[model samples]
Target: MSRDEQLRRAAYEEMEKHKDVVEKDPYRLHYHLMPTVGLLNDPNGFIQFKGTYHVYYQWMPFKTGHGAKFWGHYSSNDFVNWTHEEIALTPSEWYEKNGCYSGSAIEHDGKIYAYYTGNVKDEEGNRETYQCLAISEESLHFDKRGPVVHLPDGFTAHFRDPKVWEQDGAFFMVVGAQTRELKGAVALFRSDDLENWDYQGVLTGGGEGRLADFGYMFECPDLFPLGERDILIFSPQGIEASGMKYQNVYQAGYVAGQFDSATGTFEHGEFEELDRGFDFYAPQTTLDDKGRRILFAWMSVPDQNEQDHPTIEHKWLHTMTLPRELKLVDGKVRQVPLEEMEDLRVGPAIQVNVELNRETRVLKAVKGKAFEMEITDLSMTEGWFDLTVGDGIRFVYSSGEQTVTLERKSYVNGVVEKRQCSVKQLNSLRVFVDTSSIEVFVNEGEETFTARFYPSPNNDTVRFETSHQAVFTIRKWDLKHVNLK
Candidate 1:
């Protein structure tokens, strides 16, 4: 066998040895694709090709830490149900000897083309990167195309995560880059045959010195046309906490503005954090054949210590959030769960449209780990309302103060705890309740809190109490049972 074949077989053998432990992991989600073992980060090569949605991720199969990265593949017919495919590309080939890092996928004619970043470290341990390509005519078996485009000038080796799309009979790509001066920026390139690329120029850069540096280098830069505006999403590494945003160790956010393909320059405004949570990064977008832009985020962030994760004992490191539909409305983007999730509603959901009486309402007829609730405010003298979801977990939406705060007591069974995000207004609220988590999206994605809770199954009751007379329209849907892959 060739050396590449030997390395592939060895990596596959390592993954096979841990199958039992991976399957027995207790922290696995019911529906999301998780690492059977080791660390999984950065949703790479996300695309819907040949009628199936393919999602590849950064995987290190041997241990629960980031080491010897490879591309792990999973496909879905409905986006809700996923099937694990064979490993797409291991770091066995000469081009990707160190690791095959994050990149996007594209469907050309009838074949699926995967473009990723190849990592190589020389004897001195100096890092070298190449934006590489591989193709799969059958969508399962792949043919390595080798490194199609070498790194252009005026940038450091921090360049990676290529996002490609077709426009006006030509293909375009945006890569996260850092200048020799250590400034964060994104580089744009144009291609016709997907082999040779012409470097355009710096798409965005030099905002507020290195502090607004967000990071010394922006990783996973994604730019796609959304409705009337263009959205550029990236992971900025060195952002400091100025006020409400950028409080996390790292920030995965987007800047909305206009893109000029002719000049390869994007003039965008301030960056907005996509998901205000403990875990969110390297988000990528793909437009379905129908033209709707859908997004998936890396649900695990690099925070605290590797061993501090509660799910470490389970062997896997991370999972992705539910698929969300992105719609640009009135210049801002709004994210809502796809309609396919509605099929998860099992029992008859009870939705009440009523006028408030200033008194608390305690309804014990319904309770579950997976549920969706939509609350619409009709009119209220007092703007504050409390949504109590068992125990001391209270979601306070104060319209008068224009802030929404989520407070939890004994949250996540004392395993994980957090108090994050403040949204404005109480007009409309959607709450997703999971077995050990609660995700609240206020005013249609204006602000979101992806958080965890650990209450007894018996205490899953949802109650509502108000400060004054306020009319409300409540719609509830019990999510379909998920057999988490």
Candidate 2:
């Protein structure tokens, strides 16, 4: 047997030994992709091949920290039901002796081609990166073909996370990079075949003046066309906080702009954050067979609240956000829950209209840890309104101020932390609650807030209160469990 196969089997054996302990962690998500053991980081190599959707993530099966990562695999026919696959890539090659970092997947000439970063360090502790490729015909087992694209000029070893796609008869790859001068940027490359690549140039950098620019180093770059323009999605590190934005140590946002293929430059607009919440980063997308752009993000931010997570005692760490279908409307991307999710709704939705007037709260079968809720036709006279989910999280909106806030009990300092954004008006709200996470879609996806918090699993109460008169209609649906077997 190959050394890669040996490492993969040994990791699976470790997972088997910890299954009972990990399963006992109440924070384990019911319908999200999480590591069987150890840590799960960025969503890597996401694609839909031959009508089967495959999601490969960064996994370290030995502990709950960022270490040598293996690609954990999950497959789904519809986004609603998923089946876990074997470990995809193991750190067994000389170029990737340390780890196989984040990358993307594309189907080329009747085979599934996986492009990723090979992270290795020499004995003297120097870093080296290789833009590598592997191919599989049946999408079951892969044969490593080694590096297809070498490191180009001006960029350091931080250049990784290659997102590949085919456009106009040629393949284009966008990779996160940092120049030797320490400026963060996304570099562009072109290829007629996946084997040979030509570095075009840095598309943009992290200075305040350029398009798609902000941060010390960019990571996980994805560039694709949406609506009438193209969107470059990336996670930028080293951005200082601007009001309620950039609160996390890293930020995952995008620049909506036009890409000139002839000149290999992207002229874009401002950087808008994709999610306004505490626990979202490193998002990736793929166009499904149905022509809809579907996205999945690693549900935890790096170097923030990770140590405070309660799941580490059980030998697991994080999850992926529920699959969201993306649509570009009015020059902004809108994310709606996948329509296939309705397959998991248990019963008829319970609907009611609640009128608030300086009262504490009220509830009637409107609370659950795993359910969906929609509020619409909002009417308010004055003052702010709040809805408390579980014991540690709350959602507040003030129509008088045109602001919405998501507050959580800080795992960092055990105090309240909030992320606030202006919404112009409170048209409606759609919220999804799972075991340890909440995702809110505002105004038909004009804005979104995603968060993960560990409230007492037994406490599933949702309550609403207001300081003045207000009225809103609420519909709640209890979601059925999809066994992750």
Candidate 3:
């Protein structure tokens, strides 16, 4: 066997050893693609081909940790059930010696094309990136087309993660890149035959007047049309903490704007973060047949020094969040859980109107760690309102004079970690509570909080008692059994 085949075989063998723990129980994913084992990062090549949704991911098969990259495949008919496929692109080719990084997939005529980045390290430990392409005529067998577009002209080896889409009868691609001066930007390209690409100028960059600083570099840049405007999604590195922003080691988000293909520049407004939870990054979207824009994101930050994660002992480290429908609501993208999740609701349900701050406190059967609750503020109230849902888990939504602070308690041992931004409009709040997670969408995405929790099963009662009195409407739903096999 060839040396590349040896490496591919070694990686596959490692995945086999940790298969049990890696493919364990999946939680809270409504209708989206997820990993079966090990670590799943960037959402590579998402396409709907031959009446099936094919979603591939940046996979590391060696260990539960992020190792050499592999393109892991999955297919779904209704976005509900997924069938895992064999490894699509193995690192058994010289063009992709190190690994096959993140990219997008497309279907043309009858063939499915997978475009990705070939990442390699030279003898001197220098990184090399080749924009690679491959073809799968039958969706199972692949023929590597080798590197189609090499390092264009001015960028360094930091160039990677190509996202391709067809618009207005032509194909356009955007890739995350960095200048030789170490500035972060996205390079644009136009391709006709998927093999030949014409280089366009820098689409946009992160600088002083820019939305974000031109940090070390950007990765997994994705551009798509949303409503009347355009949305640019990417992961920016080296953003320092400035008060209430950039809390993670690396940030993945989007900029609302309009992309001008004529000048290759995107006139963008302030950057809006996609998620406020502990882990989310490298999101990619695909347009479905129904004309709805659906998106999926890696639920963990990249290159994090995760050592003692409980799941790591079992051999998997990450998962993807539920598939959310993306809509541009008032200049910001509003992500709502898909309607298909409603099918998971079984048994009798209950709704309540809780008068906050009263000793009326806990609602009877209205308690669960895994359920949905929508709270609408009838009047603007002051002080803090605590919604305790069994055990020590708390949903602290404080309308502190100016803004609302949404925090999750008893997560990871009483951390009381705060995700999502505060809602200034203290009029109402819509929340969804699951057995082990909480998702708060304030005023339809003006602000949102998605969190994971671990509370005992017996402690499933939800209590609502505020520090001050505030009239409210709470609607609850008892979810059906989730078959996470």
Highest TM-score: which candidate? Answer: 2
CA lDDT of every candidate: 0.76, 0.88, 0.72
Per-residue lDDT tens digits for candidate 3, residues 1-485, read 87657766876787677666554543323333445556777777888788888778888776677656888888777665677777788776766777898899888879988889988887897888889888998676688888987887778999999888877667788989987778888889987777898888788883434744647788899999899999999998877766667766788888988887656678888777787765678888988888888887776777654544455666665666666788988888988776665665556557666676545477786775556666775553677676766664565656675444545553345667655455666555656665455666667656655555555657878777677777777767766544333
Clashes of 2: 0
State the TM-score for model 3.
Answer: 0.88
Model 3 clash pairs are: 45-104, 45-105, 206-214, 367-462, 369-434, 369-435, 370-434, 370-435, 371-433, 377-428
Which one wins on lDDT? Answer: 2
Candidate 2, 210-310: lDDT as tens digits: 74346679999999998899999999888899887888889999989999887888888888999998888999999887888889999888988687788
**Which stretches of model 1 miss by more than 4 angstroms?**
1-26, 122-125, 206-214, 304-306, 352-362, 388-394, 407-424, 452-473
Per-prediction TM-score to the true structure, in the order listed: 0.89, 0.98, 0.88
Please provide, for model 1 over 309-333, each residue's C-alpha lDDT reduced to its tens digit, 9 standing for 90 to 100. 5566666677776677888877777
TM-score of 1: 0.89
